[model samples]
Target: MSKALLVHPDDSVATLVEPVAAGESVTFAAQVVTALTDVPSGHKVAIRVISAGDPVVKFGFPIGTARTDIAVGAHVHTHNLATALDGTLDYRFTPSVPFVREAVAETATFQGYVRSDGRVGTRNEIWVLPTVGCVARTATRIAALADAAHGGAVDGVHAFTHPFGCSQLGDDLAGTRSILAALACHPNAGGVVIVGLGCESNQIAALLAEIPEARRSAIRTLSTQLAGDEIDEGVALVAELVALAKAERTTVGVDKLVLGVKCGGSDGLSGLTANPLVGRMSEAVVDAGGSVLLTEIPEMFGAERLLMDRAADEVVFDRTVKMVNDFKRYFLDHGEPVSENPSPGNLAGGITTLEEKSLGAVQKAGRAIVSDVIPYGGQVSRAGLTLLEAPGNDAVSCTALAAAGATAILFTTGRGTPLGFPVPTIKIASNSGLAARKPGWIDLDAGAVLEDGFDAVADDLLARLCDIASGAPTAAERNGEREIAIWKRGVTL
Candidate 1:
């Protein structure tokens, strides 16, 4: 494998695939340059002289402006680079990217639970959701009791606890209700028991009214206020759900699957390895007629146009424009920088700016056309690449993806995280080191892309994911790290 990788011809720097010592000769993109200083693996090395304030290009786009004159072979990172992004800006619908539809070959399939409403689920579990944070512990206790008694029958019994639904008004209350309603209808849950605290803003009756009519039969509701014994009532409801979800798995086509592509704790190798690998998997799933949801709006700041240009129609392009600009306005509205990302872990892992991160981050979408753009807590309607409105935060974005109808999430990480979503989260490590060190966190190692190429790795990943969809446990599931976090963006009374 090459010691360094230059992602684009005009890039001023190349990513060192492996750590290189000072004075060591590095070859990238067929060009040789001696390292002037020790550069860590996944870090950048200047390939050419860059004047101060000049743009540093990567992925054939400017990532940031150089803070000082950068000499060839010198290390390039936050110390010498600063984001060029500011507040919200005007956008035009210029859909220039061509969308090629690949013919599905043989049509891949997985064994999944097919719901009565025609939706497919990768897991057969019972979910307990609280209508208010006041009942969070009660919900957890109920889930624990149910899992201890009834987990062996279905996939498992789990509860998603959150601290909202009360003291929230307007969009905040609506957002919480939407997410809960979405979870209630998720196919993964064989039965859903909605625990309510009686008079919370997110009342059970109101929340149930929002759940899809087709999925309402599988959902059960219980109010602690009306229960003779809240825990006993919750356990009984969960038991009923388990019995309802006890249906056998059936062979379903890949098109029935909804895959969520995301990356957190990203390092420079993320773009080259895991992200690209996940992109191939995304392309495969899309080609097979499945839907792929890509979130992390702020991470697409500089790379937004690339996605916009691939919009399926003028309406999608317009919606994509709104999604991007609205996120920027959100940042500016709060006195925060629009490009406030490449978090500490991201920088430590070698990402310099949100642009550089965005360019790499968007690779998970592959080259699919944007079929739609869903709002913060909206459900997915089409079967193609849909851009969901969400922040760059991990748990919040993953939860949004789950609420948007993803059965499984493919999360690529270079730095590693133990967090998991309400759904199955298959962790792909960008580097082999992280995979080796965090065996309990990573399900696949995408570093093989550098040695074996994306074709082989993606093929393997797809097969593994199909197995996971058939009820195989992911690293997160095996470690019992399931959790959820809703985006609270409005007034909280």
Candidate 2:
């Protein structure tokens, strides 16, 4: 394997393929250079002398400015570099990439649960939803009871408990209601039992109004205050839904698949391995006439233009611009730097600035055109690629992806996490080391891309994803890490 990788010809820095000590010779961009300082694997090292305030190029774009004159072969990170990203700025829709839609093979298909409304589901399970946080435990208890009694009759019984639906105002309250409503309507839930506290601001009636009447038959409602035994009532309701579902799976086209692309605990090799590997999967899914959703708006601070340039049309380009700038405004309004991302975990994994991180994060989207832009708590409409408005937080963005109608999420991580949203989340490891160390956490070894090539591994990944879609459980699901988190951006009442 190469000692270091020069991502782009214009890059002045190269990522270390392995740790190197001072005075060690390493080849970068086909040129040998002596390491001036110790550099860790996945961290950047200056391949050329960079003057103070001069831009440090990586991935063929400027990640940030050098804090001081960086000598050739010196380590390049936060200590010698800082983000150039700040408050919102004006953007022009200069289309650089042309939209080229890949042809979908008519023969591609997967086994899925076809809903009455024509939507396809990757699972046939009973879901217990709470209209208010007050009934969260009640919902969980009911799901546990139902799972114990009727789990065999269905895929499984799961409860998505969250701490919202009350004491929230404006968008915050509406976001909670919308996300709950979306879950209630999710096709994966062959039957749904909505548990309510009877007096929360997010009333069952209001939430039901958001769902179509066509889906009402599959959804059962219960208010603890209105029932003598809410758990028994909820279980009975779920049983009836289970009977109605029959736990049957039918063949569906790849067009029915909706995938959410995400990454967490990313390390240096994330961009080179796991992310790009997932990017191939994303492109293949899109080429198969399926839809893909990508979130983490803040992480796109520097790489936003790459997505904008791939917008399907002028309208989509405009929406993409607004989504990026508005997220920046949100940070500025909160007195936080726009680059206040790349958590301690990210830095530890060899990431430096938000720009470097953003560039890597956006790779999960592949080269698909932006078909639509979804707001927080909104559902995906267009089928190609949708850019969702969401923060960089893992839980929040994963929840948003689930609420946006993704039946399964492809999550790449260098530092593993056992977090799962309502849908199945497949964790792909960026490095073989992490995969070997945490077999229970990683579902796929994307690090193999470095050795076996992306196409070879992506074919395996696509197969794995199909198996998950066809009822195979993921690591997260097997570990019982299901959860939901709504983004709260407003004050409480």
Candidate 3:
């Protein structure tokens, strides 16, 4: 028999790590009760009888309400319980007073690669950015050439080619340009080779003009037509840039680090462990004069007001609101409800609605004041916590954050995920079971918080954060999982 943990003494439910047969005696608290139904891993079981319409509590908070009468030892999940949004009540926001410690004023630092523009990087690599769909193959060829030329000196050459960048209008085209420009200026990138087809609507000149002047010199533009479609010439150009990038080495401080916070494969333990631990580390980075980015706009659905209240100024607040509303509009325009987030895995893991998931997901931002709200692919100039406009899709969100100058990322998972970004991504497992089961993917086990305390887990997380930033490879990095996906809005045509 495997153990099921009761997160808090007041928690009405306990999570089961293994299936419990009906009629089997299960010890909960100091009492033993017969299992009313078979409860599977990642599912919850009621310790006491619950009536219909009664709130089902987990983590000592109402996760949802029972749709039908539930008996003691009964399985608590989607079939029996429904989300709070299905009920007719507005939730009041009572700010949680987290235990605080005296501020650490001393600067904690890390060694990084410093750019000429005063920006710093954790990794140095050459990028092959395709400006149009027509030249994506050319960019891929360049990546291959650069890899062959540089051998193992360069981290790796990549072609960030996408489906769009042509046949778009208004904000769609503008958004593509902004995203590409941001990638060109990303700290991880030592140099960029923009490959384009001469007649494509997304011209190289327009993309160059959008980049900041300080980073413009590192960007080299080449067109397939100009290169006479000769793959060798294009390969040679990429090789030359790769040589320049390989010569650059790492050296800077932790303050120069820009970290991206993201959560995926969430479970009931997300709020109880990994997210909060990451939040503490995020605050530590901000206090050290480093920047952190918290994105996934739709994931902020129910928690937008919390962030708005923390906005540094009215301008930042308004931008935050607009970003939230824009995501809502985008979802509705696609004939889908905004609440259609939190995939089946999340639901299976006890998260019911977007609101429930949002409340927990926002915890990754910690208590930092919102400094700025940036659109997808927008440059992150201001420090502190920046609200990036992006969807909750892991690949798309991580890609956007990396493009926006994040030198590394801290990714939280609950149900087990094995994905990494182009930059180093530290995977924090929300539960010990997942960590143990998928030891190859999870780098940190935040599940200790459930058994020990939040403070202890937070200390462990911060230590791991420092180690990861200092060139220690995360599980995702070791697995060679460099996943990347750009969020696409508007028509695909």
Candidate 4:
């Protein structure tokens, strides 16, 4: 195998695909260099001489600055590098067109359930939501019993419980209510049952008021304060909704598809393998006249410009700027720097700075022109690429994607995670080891791209996801891993 990989021609360092012992000779970029220090797999090794205080380049961008003079083949990471990003900066609208288009002309279709409201759903499932934390367990019990009793009725039953709706004031409570309302109205959910304690700050009445009138008919609400037997009552209500949801299955074109994109537990090979593979899938779906939602606002740090320049119009460009800066301000307002990322896992996996991570994370969006922007807890407003606002937390961002009407989420991870969201969350592993280690967690392996090339692997991944859209369960679904967490941006009373 090759000793290391040079991601871009301008990169000053190369990523080691395997451990390199000290004094070992390896060739990179047509030059032979001896290793000055032992570097593990996925770690960076300097391919050229870099003076102290000079930028340490990777991914063809300055990830950080060298803390000290770096010799050839020296390990380049936290000890030798530091982030150059500070607070937010001014941004301008400079549109750049994507040279390559990944969308196709022919129509691709998936089997889905069509609701009375004319929305298409990849699954026919019932979602149980608790308006207040006090009734969270109550919602879970109802879901368990309903799923057991009506196993053959629809797809499945799930309960998403969150610790909110009580003691939360202002926007925090509003955020909780809006997110719950959004999930309750998601197209994947054929039916919904919202349970409430009746006295919490988030009332069932106010929550229902936020849902569209047409969607309300498929939603059933209950108050534990009034119901004689909440569990039985909920199951009965679910039975009625099951009957409504079991109507019929129809074939829908790619235009009816909305795919959510995210990456978590990323490693050095993420951008090279899994992320870009998902990007190809994104371009394919977007080109076929479908919508793709990209969230995790804070993760867009150094790579925001790449997306901004691809904005379809000035209006979208402006909105994209506001979203990026607003998220940065949220961090500054909390006395945290905008570059507070590349967590402990990320560091161990060879990621050095937020800039480096962002550059890789945004690859999931591919080269498609961003068509629109959606606020936190908002749904997709248009087709093609749409950016959504949410923090970098995995659960929160994936939940935001699901709440925004994603039929299925394409989640790439170099370091594996078993966490799954409400809708089908397909975990694509960046390296072969992780995929082999977590067969039950990973749905597809992007590691094959190294041998089979991106086009072949991208085609395989797109077909796998299309199968998932057409009633084939993902590894997460097979493992029974469905969860939801809301973004709380307010204070508690």
Candidate whose lDDT is highest: 1
Q: Tens-digit lDDT track for model 3 on 1-493?
A: 4457676777777776556888876665566666787766666788888899998776566666889999888878878877664211233333343335554523556666777778887777788888887777778877887677774776777777777678877778888888888888887888888888888777889999988787776777887787765477666766777667754555455677798999999986686578988888778777777889999888887667778777777778777777787777777777877677779889877676666688789889888888888878776888889988888889989988988889889999998888888788999998888999999999989888767888777777766776677667789878867756766666655
lDDT tens digits, residues 294-332, model 1?
A: 999999999999998899999998899888998888899
Which residue runs of candidate 1 sit more than 4 Å off their true CA positions? 97-106
Cα-based RMSD of the predictions, in order? 1.4, 1.5, 3.4, 1.4
lDDT tens digits, residue span 1-493, model 2: 3388888999999988789998998887669888888888889889899999999998899999999999988999989999998788777777765545555334566799988878899988999999888999999998998899989989899999988888988888988999889888887889889999999989999999999899898989999999998888888999889899885688887788899999999988898899988888778788877899999999999999899888888899889889888888888898888988899989988999999999999999988888999898789887899999888889999999988899999999989998988999999999998999998988999988878988789878988988899988898888999998888888988
Which residue runs of candidate 3 sit more than 4 Å off their true CA positions?
1-14, 17-19, 23-35, 47-50, 59-61, 86-100, 103-107, 246-252, 313-315, 437-439, 448-460
Against the hidden reference, what TM-scores do the models get? 0.97, 0.97, 0.87, 0.97
Error of 3 at 8 (Å): 6.5
- lDDT value, residue 123 of candidate 2: 89
Candidate 2 wrongly placed segments (more than 4 Å): 99-107
Q: What TM-score should be assigned to candidate 2?
A: 0.97
